[model samples]
Target: MREEIIVSGRNNPLIDPLLHVWHWEIPVYLFLGGLAAGLMFFAALYTIRNRENNYKVAVQIAPMFASIALILGLGALFLDLHHKLYFWRLYTTIRLASPMSWGAWILMIVTPISFIWSALHIKSIFPNWDWKFEVIEELLEFFTKYKKVLAWIMLISSAILGIYTGILLSAFNARPLWNTSIMGPLFLASGLSAGTAMVIWISKNHDERKRFAQLDLMIIGIELFLIIHMFMGFLASTQVQIDAANLFLGGEYTASFWIFVVILGMIVPAILEGLELKGYKIPIVIPAILVLFGSVMLRIIISYAGQASRWLY
Candidate 1:
């Protein structure tokens, strides 16, 4: 009777029955951060390679997206904190071993660079295009006029940020659903897919369209591999992990996991990328949009669902 009572409750259906566990805040952070980082990296890549008339636009837009992610990421962190005022305390000290500390430091470092980079490009909009306004451009030009170097640095940093987002979740060994090392790569891959899709949607011209199409295929392939590994963890892990998997695969959260994550986020993006590869462009755009939105929803569901299931157990 005690066991029966333990598994059944109203609050248990939405939150951890233990009351200490809330919604899946960490997972949500991972998702948004990955998407943001990925978008910034890829956009930087394209800007370097093409140097299209719109290179300035790419620089401007990518940072804006990244900044949005930073804002949302910080908000999520604040919400997760039981005492919001102590949020400043995170920056006051640093712990190398803590993934949260690492993430905070990374965000602190990357966001400013991105903003300055974007601001440098903004001078292009001025009619005179004077060299006086943006000092960073002068510095960037002095060390590396080649956009590719910039792209590579941005790519590497974004990849680190993307993987770090996953690492944050995996660091929590107590959460069976998040303990898998696979989460880091999986999050990085999804970040790429979602980020590339966002760029494709926002981009203009045949060159961008064609280039992003190729990128889409590559991203889809990576995302699929990550999904396979995620499921492999479920198959290979202990009972607690298996039980957690069931929550995503067959229980109350099944609709969200399957509908948003598996189908809309992954499969549709694959199909769309395939169509783009086959020279069908229009067919690909809609699915790209779906995948972007679905990616966001996927994070929300996993975060909430994972915690909710803990309550049941």
Candidate 2:
């Protein structure tokens, strides 16, 4: 007689025939987290280069957005938690191998730093703003005194946060759609591109807008390149991976991915920025809005599509 042992678990809950776990909350959280990371990254970057004052929006304004985005993102994450009361247990220990572990700690560290940085600049953004709380003033003063150190820390933290956004998705090796290392850089590029577009929109100075537009344009180019490479990698891999790529290439996500994410989001913005650089009167907000819209949509599509990429079905 021949005896055989059968594997008990070869199925996926996410890509089941009719069971979907995550909802809108997850994609919203991811988009906002990436956006906040981008804002903080650029804010710290300008401060480190001593160009913060020149780019007032980058330093003063963006941190405020970052702070708000972090709060809202965390709120969205909380809503998606199956065991909401047990969420704090994530802080009890660190797991270097776990992407969720890294993200939890990174988000905790980043949230406070972003809020404090924004608070420090409150006076600068609003001259008439008055709060005479003694302890608060002292804390802000201390943060201001060592702001250079804070900026450096923020630069590193923000970069990690931005990369973490993608790593969270890609680390799920079972999800063939997001199983590539390129997701890290691709998401980072998307975040930086959105951040730069916001800076361009907020800046009142033509030269500042122009400089950031050039930077945004360059990042968009890099983003497109990475996207192409991601597809090439997928197409060259296994059948499941190729099926995953087809989701965006010519499958269900074809129109959404190509039209909203690729064309309107990156290409149109690139064209608008180029025209602006070429002495045309393109409204800066147009490109900025398109970039931001695309960023959020990309997260939503990726989050949803990844869940559908498993071969169990």
Candidate 3:
């Protein structure tokens, strides 16, 4: 009788395995955080540039949504915690080297500023609300008096918040896709794009809507470049990095990445916006909706695909 030999496939011990510890909460938190940051930043800008229109949706309504979005995003982050009760530990210390530490501190500062920004426009949003209450009147007066200063502070803080969303992921070097310096700016652009889309959707001013659409087109263009640059950097890196890049190129996430994020989210919106700019009378809401949806999908795809990347063979 002939001896039979059998071999079984096994994973390489030298390679580090991919981790799926992050889930839907992470992406949702990131998306909402970025969206809030963008909205607050633009609200501040609009307040400073066009104070005459204090009652406009861009100034009053957007800031209100910004505050709400930040609160909801924080709720998601809280839920994502394993020791939800110990969430206060993040605030107990400020580690200069820790991205999470930076994020905690940033969120702490940004949330109040956002609310203050919205509060400054309370009279415009709720004209019928009674200001007869002494404390309520005093609080509103204080915020209104220092509105300019608050706007400047909100702009800076919101920009940091948007950038921090990307930095949070980029700090995780174990994921090759997230380990890039460009991620911060890329995320900022995406957030701004989403923010502009939101403003376009809500603002009643035709000219303001047109301006935001143009701005979004520019942001989307920059994002496209950054994405290509990111992939180029990955391709030029080590084998592990190349493998990580493959996830977007021709691997598991290729179709969704290209279809949803690239084509539908970016290209199509840009085209529609461009046509609207050229007197084509395209429905601004359509492109705005697409951009917003794309922004969420972009965050989801990057969050999942980044986790899928590993150094192991």
Candidate 4:
């Protein structure tokens, strides 16, 4: 008898019919890290917005965390590139039509803007009283004069960063799991949720608690609505799309999607925010940590599973 053979290559029918090579781990890491950085940017922006100086300490510290996330995100993005040497060419050519290209450009713009804004804001808090370099003094003075501009840029960029990350995933229409028009808005809500949650959890001062709680509730509601819309859209989609949805809802990614993303990221946060809004402070900080961890895992699972399955009927 002839030996039986098992084939699972490009010619296999059960395999992904459309083979678009992916750099997987790096892209998913970038997605999660970028959103985390964006969330921190929003946290900083909110501190300035509320005219709350007590919150400034947390805001200042947040950018350090954001900086780490952004650096790791950029590193992942760079690693995903096949030709790392020609990466500079992306900056030279601005293609508005391409979301990946546009996202790269927007991220590039936001990162430095955030860094400068964070630096100026920090300088405002810790003023250099040394009578050493006149140039440094003059520069600091200049920054003080345009502090409002920096704040505005920071706020606007936070918004852009929040949505841009989702748009980056939605750009791939072939992947029905990520092609939701609601994703951009959903991402913004989730970013705000994570951002405000972080600020609240890290806050030493009790004065800003109410405002952070309010922000958390607002973001949670919006996120819930967007998730509903996303699911509805998916359920109403074509066969291929439904197949894609199964990959998350009932397929391989079900556990992560339900446990981490839905239960922890959404449900726990909503309940905690609700209690917070009702002025019930029975040590609600743990839920905030849970939600933050859930948000990170959600990004990883969604990015990974959305592209992991085969779409053949």
Error of 4 at 51 (Å): 1.0
- lDDT (10s digit) by residue, model 3, range 1-313: 7663334544444232456677788888888889998898888887778653743777778878888888999999998898988899998899999988998999999998887777667777688867677997798788788888888888899999999989998998888989988889988888889899998998888887888888899999999999999999999998878988999888999999999988999999999999989999877889988988888888999999888886643
**Tens digit of per-residue lDDT, candidate 2, span 96-214:** 99998999999989999998999999988799887778899899999999999999999999899889989998998888999999999989889888888888878898878988899
Q: Is candidate 1 or candidate 2 better by lDDT?
A: 2
Best by TM-score: 2
Give the RMSD in angstroms, all C-alphas superposed, for model 3. 4.4
List runs of model 4 lying over 4 Å from the truth. Answer: 1-50, 123-134, 276-284, 309-313
Among the numbered candidates, top lDDT falls to 2
By summed lDDT, which 10 consecutive residues of candidate 2 come out lowest? 10-19
- Over 154-239, each residue of candidate 1 has an lDDT whose tens digit, in order, gives 76788789888778767876777777888788778777777777777776655665666677677777777777778777868787
What are the per-model numbers of colliding residue pairs?
2, 0, 0, 0
TM-score per candidate, in order? 0.82, 0.93, 0.91, 0.83
Shift of residue 176 alpha carbon in model 1, Å:
0.5
**Candidate 3: what lDDT?**
0.86
Which of the two candidates, 3 or 4, achieves a greater lDDT against the reference? 3
Off by over 4 Å in 1: 1-28, 46-60, 124-153, 281-284, 309-313
